[model samples]
Target: MELTFASYNIHKAVGLDGRRDPDRIMSVLREVDADIIALQEADRRFGARASVLPRALLDDTRWRPLPVAKRPRSLGWHGNALLVRRDIKCLHAEPLDLPTLEPRGAVLAELDLRGEHIRVLGAHLDLSGLRRRDQIKAILKQCTRRGKMPTVIMGDFNQWGRLTGAMQVFGMGWQQITPGASYPSARPIARFDRIIATPDWSYETSGVHHSATSAAASDHLPVWASLRTA
Candidate 1:
């Protein structure tokens, strides 16, 4: 099976124009229209971690956010959320807490798409280099405890080097997709956002979502990839 996956750091719906427009964020999402989306900074950092994307507005779409939020008003855990096609069945969902100085964590969602189980980890690591390494190790350790399957981890990794920093943890069996620079959407020069899949999946096409709206929607442009089952 082939599917398209996207990772976007919405900056909590705050645009470069100094506006928090959830509608504009939604519009950008519609433009990408990926099968599975992993979003970072989807909710406010404080005050109940309230979702930036209106639930009512999302309900109208073919996609649905997984029930991984700890709070009723929050759409994700630690500002990380997963949105999958409504047709895909959710098998399990949980939050993965990382060792960090601030509020930081990840979400793991196991989904069933036409009987094939796919595991996805949506995470936003800390900015501190040391913390990011520890966070990546923790994420990998957690995945090791779970049953093996075709897995993908996507988010704003916040790591600058493509293969020199925290990304070094994903040694073998994992293939990291570099969809090009996605940070500083206006004139992106950093690949902060990423999508990594197990060897069971092969990449077909991948790139940054550079639509006019996306360029200004947030600080980071969305990255997407088309992958096929091996």
Candidate 2:
């Protein structure tokens, strides 16, 4: 069976209303219909006026939690989340810290799907070019340490079509599957979001969801790809 996954910067699920809306975000995700999703900017809380995603969002299902860095009042549960169907079993979840002044990390998880072991890593890198370079290095180091398996890394890379640090990731043997421009939800012009996979995977189809439904949801449009796992 083919494995489908997606990566999106939910902007803490904040809509134009300026309130954290995980419910609406859930609806957007349900429309995407991907088995696994890697979300960035998933905030918990810090103080008043902070964004927090309620744990009850995925309460009805078997979606497990694997959180990473936690500030006093804010935290990103898992940096990236692995929401699998009933057939997928999570073996482990690993967190990798990237070089950033802000609280940023990656979520690495091992899952058992249809008798196959899949290694998936999700992360949201820094916005600055310099910091993004460091974050890419950190991600590569962790991938190397994790051993070679069919791996998938997806999230907001903050890369604006430059062939430097972010390009280095493609050279590391991960196929970058994005439209090359995604930002400002209304009129996207930067490829800040992505979904990449190892050579063991082949890109089947990819595109940017730029419908009216998505434009009003967040500042960035969600990018998705369907990969044929080898």
lDDT for each of the candidates?
A: 0.93, 0.71
Count clashes in each candidate, considering only residues at least 3 apart in sequence or on different chains: 0, 5
* lDDT tens per residue, model 1, 148-174: 889999999988888878889898768
lDDT of 2: 0.71
Could you tell me the TM-score of candidate 1? 0.98
For candidate 2, lDDT tens digit of each residue in 159-226? 77755665575685678777556688877888878887888887788878776667767788888888
Off by over 4 Å in 1: none
Error of 2 at 65 (Å): 3.8
Worst 10 residues of 2 by lDDT: 69-78
Worst 10 residues of 1 by lDDT: 164-173
Residue 37 in model 1: shift from native, Å?
0.3
Evaluated against the true structure, the overall lDDT of model 1 is 0.93
TM-score of each: 0.98, 0.87
